[model samples]
Target: MIRLSRIPHQLLTWGIPMGPLMLLRTRGRHSGLLRTVPIATLRHDGHHWLVSPFGDTHWVRNLRADARAELGRGHRFRPVRLVEVDDDRKLEILHAYRGAFGLVPFVRDAFDADAGAEPHVFAREAHRHPAFLIQPAG
Candidate 1:
């Protein structure tokens, strides 16, 4: 259902804004097939980020096995290296994600921390939601 909803946004031209959503393409660990899903990104502290509001999901597992993935916004897809952010550095990203997207019910419900919660609140909540910093792949 989520994938279906994102198809239109995936087709839009790169110049147009599509909010924070992007199509994440990962190679399946078991099947070795390419899997795609729409996910929200956090652009914080001069870096692009990927946060799994739902915790460690399938895509997260796949990405763990293969850091090589593609992030597609509209018609433009770029190869990216997804480095799982360490807990120490993840607090700010989590806070930023909450501040930016916490209004959405799903995102809000995913964490125990409130939108205006302090950094430590997010630090405790960070384990449930894995975050990755997106870097341009060589």
Candidate 2:
């Protein structure tokens, strides 16, 4: 995991064309070691949301311990909190992403490319995956 502390490097990575990766910095819950990881993200409603296609990764664990984190999206550093969406609304949110980003096939393949499952199946599984709706701290 690459912990990004420099704003310039972050910008260079995300700012460039085809740079969709975001650098998330968090403090380890038990080890207290600062860790950084790259993730896919989408911006919405003046906030950024990150979804872990792999589910509950290390960065997610770190954020769970401490909501405070620095998001490096294309050289932009914004302090944000990891907000867990209500389970009741998880499917709705996932659907919104699918519609907004045209991610039906993409998400389906992410969950199980070989399962030959429907979009609903993928959506249901995606709900179980860890996701963070980021909001900047005032």
Top candidate on lDDT is 1
- lDDT of predicted model 1: 0.84
> Candidate 2's error at 34, in angstroms?
1.7
Which regions of candidate 1 fall more than 4 Å away from where they truly are? 1-17
Error (Å) of candidate 1 at residue 100 is 0.4
State which candidate has the highest TM-score: 1
lDDT of 2 by residue, 1-138 (tens): 234325544554566533445677788999998776666576655656777655777887888889898867455667878887756545545544444445535555455423433335545476456767887765
Over 3-122, each residue of candidate 1 has an lDDT whose tens digit, in order, gives: 554664455334355678778889999999988777888888899999998888999999999999998865678999999987587998888898999888888888899989887888
- Clashing residue pairs, backbone N/CA/C < 3 A, model 1: none
lDDT of 2: 0.63
Clashes of 1: 0
